[model samples]
Target: MGGESNRWAASGRKATAVGTIAFRQQLAYKTDFALRGFFLLFILFVFIQLWTAAYEGDFDKAISGFTLKQIVWYLVFTEALTMAAPPLCSRIEEEVKNGDVAIRLIRPQSYVGYHFSVFASEALTRFAVHLLIGSAIAWPFVGPPSFGGGWLGLLALSAGALTVTFLLLLLVGLCAFWVEETSGLYFVLQKLQFTIGGMLLPIDLMPEWLQRVCAWLPFQAALYFPARMAVHFDPALLVKQLGIQIGWIALLAFAVNRMYRRGVTKLHVNGG
Candidate 1:
């Protein structure tokens, strides 16, 4: 029992150490990081301006279930939180191609566990430095949208959303093992999310057939559904969204495990 406890403790330490290293590495480029936040703010401001122009004649009318203000704020939060989510699979794929992943595999920790720990640490740093700061700067420009739920409910939904994001991205990253490069695939998948996942336009605005298609897709569970929860809280709807989110998480996890096993055996590490 003591040995088992000791082993667990050691593993925890390793994970923590890996995460810490990643955090510090990101922190080292603080200036460039700050610029990225500025860029996000600039892009967001432009989006708002364009929407304002487009809706000038119809300001009084609600388009697609969102008032201008609500849509503006939704874009703010979406842009802020979206980038803070980790890009682990991309990083792992790069390492694999460059022969760096071999080092990770040789370590005592499992490769996926180690990468996830590092990615989580990086995400924490980004959330604090980029998302939090961006939100603060944009707050005065855009008043906070009314969050309908209690604080506890909001937190649960936010955390659950982040978990779903990580799991989905991780699953997508696993494709690195099978595909030669994931850039094109990631681009297409992300754009589909923007269009179908209700990021670019609300699902309510989408045609009935499109909404039906999105209902089954995992993308909506990633950004759109959670963003909806933040803006409008319906307990029943939250539960339904969470149920679907968990179902996708489980399915993706099973698929990832299968792919990772196959990848480990077939991965040809040519020296880059």
Candidate 2:
């Protein structure tokens, strides 16, 4: 038991190191970082204009339980979360096609863990950057962000959302093991996330039937719940949302693990 515990601890340290490396790699690409930041600003500016028009320049007007300011803030958070996600599916598919995954598999760390570390690091870095850019742009227009649930709650929910997103992307990427291309699958996944996942519009603002449908899907756990919680957090709702996020994360992680195990067995390596 002691030996097993030590092995687990070592794995944790390795994952952290891998994540740190990935984070630094992201920062190394200054051009890409600047472009992403600019793009985030543009997106926030467009959303601000659109939402302002929708509210007819009435910031205090409430639409579907969300004041214009709350809606703008919600969009800022949602868009940041959405844009922060790297093209993990495409990266995984490419690695699988080029046999890079075989090299990864031979490494000391678990292939899935390595990918998860990289994905989490990249996503968190981008998320933070996008959030800062969006917040800075949205602040003068929308005033301050709602702090109904406190910063800790927002951070916790954001972390859960990112984890859920990574697992889902991992599952989609692992499909490359069987299918020659996963881009179409990823495209569909992205659309679902933007539409029903609450990135494009809050679930509460959707039609009742659509809202009911989103409630059953895991997409909301990744986008809608966290964004909504940011704008109008309820303590009881936070507990419920966290519980749901945990459930989705558990299920998605299990799927990712199973897929990786089965997929790796089918992996073919050539020329060392």
Candidate 3:
């Protein structure tokens, strides 16, 4: 029994190794990723032109705490951050519907852990790609965002944001075990994140009441906090937001794990 357990542990490690490789493989298409960068560049330029025009007639130099340049740069960070997240939750939905998760069930590995390893690897890769390309494009316009506390905090917050996002989506994916089709959930999740997480719009620009309400949601912690800090680094706010990010990540991790355990049990009972 002990030997069997040892072999199982070894196999899980092997599965994790494969998960890591799979994520790296996503980077093989250099041309495709570069084109994606250009697409974002085009959008950034158009927004820059629009905002520049709008602000041209304004006597006020800043709107809602952001200058014309900062507003555009804020979008630069948030768009890249929102886009960096993989849509693997939909993949989970499809696999569950098609009964393909059965193959994963017999493997001597934690199914959620295996996929999350893949998600983390891919997310980090994509975040790097997005950051490099976005910065390259933004430099000619807004210049680089000031890094006050160095990149250590930035990287930490980015990782925390991604992890929290993955965990929330993992929970959504686990719901597929029962729902079989999670299109509605996916749609709602995407829209809510886009609107409330300050992906396409900066939360700083939102109405005071709306901002107060959004502050309590995990959505802000997942994307807005990190992205905001990227464009406007503040050591004091970073310390406060980092604590909030850590809290959300931990809480969401526990929730995802709980839902995963419940999902596995249901999968076994249903023989799927």
Candidate 4:
């Protein structure tokens, strides 16, 4: 049993390395990595201006416990999370539609595992790019260091949230096996995530009931919870949010594995 477990760990590490290589190749060949910084800066600049204008009209210096600087920084973090997700949904849907799953099945790796590895490296690279550029763009407006020990906590939480994001998207993409196309579902999810996942605004700004609901759900944890942690720096809340985020990741990981197992059997039954 110990040997088998060790083997699995080694395979998972190998898969992650393969994924990192794949992303590196994609970045090298597909997009100009150098230009991504400027693009992210442009996007951040727009958000900063929007929030700055919003703050000007308000009399109180704080809105929903966030100052103007925190608000802009919040948008930056949320956008980084959103931008990090590779378009796994579209890729999976295409593969399923074109019967490419058959080819993937013959590979030496778990198809879903391979995809998850790719998702991990790609998302992390994109997240880092977005974070650096977003920070630079906000520096002149918001000024110096706004995070400390909370940075490490937020960093860990962000990793968990990114995992959850990838798993959910992969599951949604796998829906193509049954639905013939999953774009409609993916579209709905994207909109819901943007609105309720705390991409456009913080979860705290929502109605009290809605805030309570989002707190328990997976949406808020993905972006808002971690971003909130970064700026707020409550050790107690940090422990609570990390627990919730890890719990959600566990649940989502189980769901993804179950769905993938079922989908594989169905594909074999139908296509084999």
Candidate 5:
């Protein structure tokens, strides 16, 4: 038991180190970082214009229980989260095609753990950057975020949302082990996230039937739940969403582990 505990501790330390390196590497690309922030700013500006027109320049007008300000803020969070996601699916597919996974699998750390550490680190950094830029652009037009005391809860939920997203992407990437091309699958996943996952619009505004369908699917846990909580926070809602996020994370993580175990067995490397 002691040896097992020590092994776990060592693995944790290794993951942490890998994550830290990934975070620093992300920071090193100053030009890319600036470009990402500029892109986020541009997106928020466009959304503000669209929403303002939708509200007919009346920021106080409520649509589906969301004021114009709240809607913009909601978009800010949703877009930030969406843009912050790393291209894990494409990266994994490429690695598999080029025989890189063989090298990665021989490493001391778990292959999934190594990739997840890198994904989480880079994604969290980009998320923070995007959020900052989006918030700066939205604040002048929408005033301050109304969820004043719930900032910590918002951050926690956002992290959970990202984790769920990462697991889904990992599963998609692992599909490369079997099919050898995952771009079509990844494209479909992106569409699901944009529509049913509520990255482009809140599920509340959708038809009741669509909302019910989203509720049954795990996609909303990655985008809708956290973004909705950010703009319209309730302690009870937070607790409920957190539970939902946790459940989705566990289920997706289990699926990822199972798929990875089977996928790794089918992995083949032809060239040096």
Candidate 6:
């Protein structure tokens, strides 16, 4: 039994190693990733131009909180941040629906850990690419954001925001165990987040009630809160938002673990 467990542990490490290698392999296609990044930069430029035109004359002086240049820079940061964001939750659901997850289940390793390891590896790779080349291009065109809070607080809040986003999506993916076909549902959810996640516009720019609603949703923590941390450095607000992000991460991680176990049981029962 001890020997068998050792072999199992070795196999798990091998699988995770393969996943890490595959992440690098995907990133090696520099042409594709660069093109995608370029498109993002181009889109930011177009939006900036439109906003610049709109803000001409009296509108320029009248606008209060964010100047035209600041808004342009916000678009730059928004593009970089969104590009670095993880893939949609639907990928895991697709794997389950297509029975691809069965292959992983046959291994001695934990399926949840394996998938998350793969995700984390890919996210790290992408983030590096974004910070290096992507940021270089965007930063020159637009100045860095003026953050109001302490740097450490903003960093902590950003970390919490990333954790919350990952956990929420993991929970969403685990829901596929019961729902079977969750792509359609995720599509609608994605649309909602795109519209209300405040990735496209600052929640502060929206109506008071809309901002209140955004505050409660997990989607806001995903992008808006982190972006706020980048631009506004209020430690008190950062602490409050970080607390919310941590709470969501904890709750979602627990919920997803339960769902994952239940799903595995169902898979075994169904003999899939």
In model 4, how large is the Cα lDDT of residue 226?
78
Question: For residues 71-115, could you state the per-residue lDDT of candidate 1 as single tens digits?
Answer: 766676566557777666678678766778778777999987787
Better of 2 and 5 by TM-score: 2
Q: Rate the local accuracy (lDDT) of all candidates.
A: 0.71, 0.87, 0.78, 0.82, 0.88, 0.68
Among these predicted structures, which one has the highest TM-score? 2
TM-score of each: 0.85, 0.96, 0.86, 0.91, 0.95, 0.80
- Residue-level lDDT tens digits of model 2 in 1-272: 99999999999999999999999999899999899889888888998899899999997789899998988888888888988888889988888778787788899998888988898899999988888988898899978885656555678799999999989888999999889499999999999999999998999889999999999999999888878888887889899999999999988888888888878777753231
The Cα RMSD of model 1 versus the native structure comes to: 3.0
Residue ranges of candidate 4 with Cα displaced over 4 Å? 30-39, 57-60
Error of 6 at 223 (Å): 0.4
Q: Which stretches of candidate 6 lie over 4 Å from their true place?
A: 1-19, 57-64, 88-90, 106-108, 131-137, 146-154
Quantify how close model 5 is to the true structure by its C-alpha RMSD in Å: 1.7
Clashes of each: 0, 0, 0, 0, 0, 2
User: Lowest summed-lDDT stretch of 10 residues in model 6?
Assistant: 57-66
Model 4 lDDT vs. the true structure?
Answer: 0.82
Highest lDDT: give the candidate number.
5
* Inter-residue clash pairs, candidate 6: 148-233, 149-233
lDDT of 6: 0.68
Query: Any residue pairs clashing in model 5, and if so which?
Result: none
The candidate with the higher TM-score, 1 or 4, is 4
- Cα lDDT tens digits, model 5, 1-272, are 99999999999999999999999999799999898889888878988999899999896689999899888988888988998898999999998888898899999999999998999899988988888889898999889997664566668689899999999999999999988899999999999999999988889999999999999898998888888887777888888888999999999999999999888777643332
Clashes of 4: 0
Q: What is the alpha-carbon RMSD of candidate 2 to the true structure?
A: 1.7
- lDDT by residue (tens digit), candidate 4, 224-269: 8878887777888888888888898889888888898899899988
